[model samples]
Target: EKRTLDVWLTVNPADYDGRAAALLIARDVTERRRVEAERARLALALEQATDAVIITNTDARISYVNMAFEKFWERRQSDVLGQPLTVLGAEDPEIVFDMQKTAMMGRPWRGRLRHRRRDGRTVICDTTGNPMRDEKGDLVAYVFVQRDITRELELQEEYFQAQKMESVGRLAGGIAHDFNNIMTAILGFGAMILEKMESDNELRHAVEQIVTAAERATNLTRQLLAFSRRGVAQVRRLDLNSALREMEGLLRRTLGEDIELALRLDPADCCVMADPGMIQQIVMNLAVNARDAMPRGGRLVISTRAVSLDDEFCRTRVKLRPGNYVHFTCSDAGCGMSPDVLARAFDPFFTTKPPGTGSGLGLSTVYGIVDRCGGHVEIESEIARGTTVHIWLPMVEAVGEAAAPTAEEETRGGSEIVLVVEDESMVRDLAVRVLSSAGYAVLSAADGREALELVEKLEGRVDLVLSDVVMPVMGGLEMAESLQEKYPHIKVLYMTGFSDRDLTERGRRVPGERILLKPFTRDALTRRVREILETAKKARTHTEAEPS
Candidate 1:
């Protein structure tokens, strides 16, 4: 209906008629201009879109693709246009067919789908498609939008896994705490009976057996606590190479002659801050796992090196930061795991080994330990190839070195006064009995509140406070804090069955603070008390000797 017109008017010169002539030229460009404007708008929209956009004809052949689509598929638009939709390689052909069917019916389709890139990598996408129609309501084409959701899906899985583990850990921690309380009484009474009996007495053997069994049970509880991330870690600066070398002989014996064990230490020393025993346990667990994987006989390689992870490398991992790290790797040439098995590898009590053959706690324990130490773990495996596990622990600039022990035999008992505070009756009784037997004057209380009252009444007479960290109405840390303010000279030894995180928000082991973990042996209890008493005595003596 729109047109461009050019018109001219001419006057005829001549005598008689003085005629006027008009000439006109008209051009219609309504459809051409309209199409040009639409093309420009569509091109701009496609060029600037963040989501992958694809336009396919009614026949399911690609008519056009946006820049985002090209980037996503790693393909050129010129080569892909007019090709079949199947060229994108749908992860599930049925899903693609269903989507096309729904769109052809003039209905919209939305779902999670996978497509393969030109490089052979598959991408997970939240895809949506809608049919485009002409003014007469006739279906012409379908427009699809896709957004990459690979990382989002990974994060979601991690979140759910963490929640499940946390719930399990809470249950495990409560059980371990109660078990420790029961075992303490069992072991303490058993030891006392054995100590009173004659060397040749028959009852002595029975009591000794009970004590031994309790010790074994204690080991199981410790593992439970470790998996719950509640066990206190005695972290120290470590030379990973030295530890691995020391473990070599033990590993060989454990592996047997059929399996070969190889150790390749980093040329540069890899130093990390971790519990020495725990680090050893990590290596041992991994090696044992590898040994189990290669039942028929295979080569196991343990290697260590220093590594630095950057921002990009750390992005996909949860709770990981970019920094210097010590890398420890354990690889086995054995039967590998399937993807389904690999995804649940770190879940608690998830094991493939037959009944009683595995506890399903080994890998889960490893995950908990590494997570507690501010480290990360990665696993890679293929069906026919092999499995490799990589562990990274942050590196620190400096760590305290332990002093060498003196050769002199020191007494393991002392006459210092100790206040025992615990809510658990059996555990409190055990502590009282142990300290009393070790020549120490022991005062007992049912809880921190009672301990505080006793301390107040004792008025500087109580030389040391040995209190449980958790209790009703009050806790050891609170009692200790009050004591420090009132009687700064008094030494406090806090004990707990709870994990380090429960004791402190930071989950840090405070320097120079004495803490004893529960379910301890009489000897361990006596030795620790003696050490703190002696140290306190030395400090008091030094203060008195100072000139005013």
Candidate 2:
């Protein structure tokens, strides 16, 4: 031993003679070192990410968090290191506890979670959490990733709303086409009866009442068509202020005394290209919603102003374009909403109220009208603070002129040999009764096939073909094409419950043509028939007069 067998030492004697030296020397640790380095690299990567990343131990205690997590929680890394993740749930700790339990069981959880920011404001985040395990497959930790999906949610809601409107439009067009035909007969008969009696007679006055009722029905059908976006839009550039002023009295009556309705209209001419009737509907629907919100009675302020939106505005708000606009604001001092409710307010059939209380199509219809008119709607609401809806319509370069009144003579027309075609028996009979009473020789048919047969059998005496669009045994379009081919001089008046585009697809043109909507009044039917027949007569005369 004193001689000390000469052992060659390449390094320190202490390093070679460590307590665990034999075991450490027997192992090759290069792969182990690489694995550890990779794990650390992954941890660092997660920590530096912008999305808040958090890891909790199996006991639901905070194990690790990235820099983003620290900022999101507004806590220092040291403070949150060993703290329970439930600490982040100042408002509701159960949310974190539940999510941790789900993840610990090897299950993943995803949902919107509410958390209190450092400033005390509520922060909503879309969160996903999954379980983590060690090499032995033991439950170790939960990894959570959270993102602010507020804007994304809003866009999704808007997309859903658009789809809903499209569906409603199709339904509305179909109903209007059928309803218009019934209206035509009702109105036509009422007009004929009224015309035969003395103005002072009680029976004549009763008939006048029928005509008035039919007219109101006609207006309703038109509204449905407008909602469906199938009705012909007579869009004109008009001042919004003047329109609002005219509607003020009507709105006051409609809202009742419970609501204190106030109109703050800017005198500046805020011109927009839109149909007056459609605009009226937009205002009425918004007012109705405002009234519903303040059921207990509150201030409803309606204001209109000129706004010039820029790119900044467009970026901040969804579905809005940067341009000059006329903004209509409807504000109500009612029970406000959480962000969740506000996001879905425009969705069709989505209502906070119990069933049978609301259809939830009010706002959806408004959105459709605005979208169809090349405008956008924005809503702002806070719980207990009430709501504000802003509708922005594009400004027009020119103002619209006042509508010209029809001449007294033009409104009156003569009875003509009218050939009426309709599928519905009730609607067909109504047209026959109404037209016959109005002093016109009317022929009725249950379908287009019967109508064409009658037309073909009758020698050159048929004046006009009043046909329904959607019918069995050949539709109105096909019938019209067949008749027009043989009798080029025969004028066709298409009546339909469907939209103009629907008929156009059947190889028929509606532009400048006398296409009547169903459920029309006696006055409307007689007037339209007269106009069509007169126009046809004029055209035939013009053709004959032209040089060959």
Candidate 3:
């Protein structure tokens, strides 16, 4: 009988005897060697791939790591090999333990796992691990594949930012639309009253009150525009300390006799790059919030100082740039907020006050305005300790003195024919009455389409088109375009209850095109209408003088 072996064998016998009966035996091993070589090649290929490849023994000790894993850890394979799987930088140690237990149980584990980078930065990664077993079905090791998705996360963040901006724009537009309508009614009615009232009479005083109310409503619309980033910001270098000092009287009146308003301005000049109107709004809103927090009498301290924030200050803060800033601090000795409430305080429509008592937009508006102006905000509060809000606006090099108030011109009347287009019958009637009493011949239209027809029929006789921006059927913008094409001589004045962006596609208000917000008093309506008519008349005279 021949002794058979798996590999080739050779026999050699120098002296053949009873002791050396079977000299040598050899069998072919080429097939088995080739098979083993093929397996090794496949394993090497998988290990060296760009995706992170790692192998761990059944005990969860790391056995192998490929080039990808080595690069990911910023270490050589020798450093990671033989290390426990937990040492491979899983952010959550429990996660690694859970995965090892599952893999040891002969089940595959796969899911996202957060891991720390060589630089100590944390990143989320997609990970999958499968139990590797021998032919006898005993667990040998676990193979893991990981993919870095930092870029994917960055892209998602960018997408979210775009969506947020779009949503904010829409919200601002809607608010402006409604506000413009209300202003239109108020202003139209006020104008009619002013036209019929005799100077220095009881009726005149009532008309003045109506006008004041309308103006305040106008201020609110402007605030909405500021929050929406659609309002025209007259940016100038101004000392905040001076502004606060000037606003002391107004703040005292606003907070009333119950609340104590205190100022703690730093002696150092704290100049900022901001719109004076917007700054006032920010101060006013914060003060109002402080007042609300203390339904009973409380102390409100408004202060300003120059601040220099370092890198350490920015680590725990969101959306903050480390630099010098003019810090406006508003502190109130009133009911404070819990951690949970403080977290959501800056979010729009998130209010702690009872419904109808607050709009919840105050803080959000302040935040938006500050952010748009390249600033940051920090809030500190604890239950029963009261709250302090610190707003940091970027400091700017002072170039000029504080802005001076412009002189108000006397009310002027016009004789030009003006077309008034408004959907609301009451508003339109009031506008017609005001304009007629002011010596301007007015043509009224219920909507843009009606106004267009009137303009086409009247042709050159119409000097200006004062139309409501939002109306049923044809909108004001479309009508303006149609009329402008036919009669280039006609000037346009857009009126709306919404923001200026409602009329402009990209939030840019056209130059020379007057925009009047709604809820305006009779005086404002009359003043704007008179101004537009006079400007049109002046332009016409100038054109005639130009000699075409």
- Please name the candidate that would achieve the greatest lDDT relative to the true structure: 1
Ranking by TM-score: 1, 2, 3
Which pairs of residues have clashing backbones in candidate 1? 230-499
lDDT of 3 by residue, 386-416 (tens): 9999888888766666654232432556788
Write down the lDDT of every candidate, Cα atoms only: 0.80, 0.76, 0.77
Report the C-alpha lDDT of model 2 over 38-101, residue by residue, as the tens digit.
9999988887788888788887778878888777768777888777776675456677777767
Model 2, C-alpha of 426: deviation from truth (Å): 5.2
Tell me the TM-score of model 2.
Answer: 0.71
Q: In terms of TM-score, how similar is model 3 to the real structure?
A: 0.61
Q: What ranking of all candidate models by lDDT puts the best one first?
A: 1, 3, 2
Candidate 1 vs 2: which has more lDDT = 1
On the 0 to 100 scale, the lDDT of residue 288 in model 3 is 91
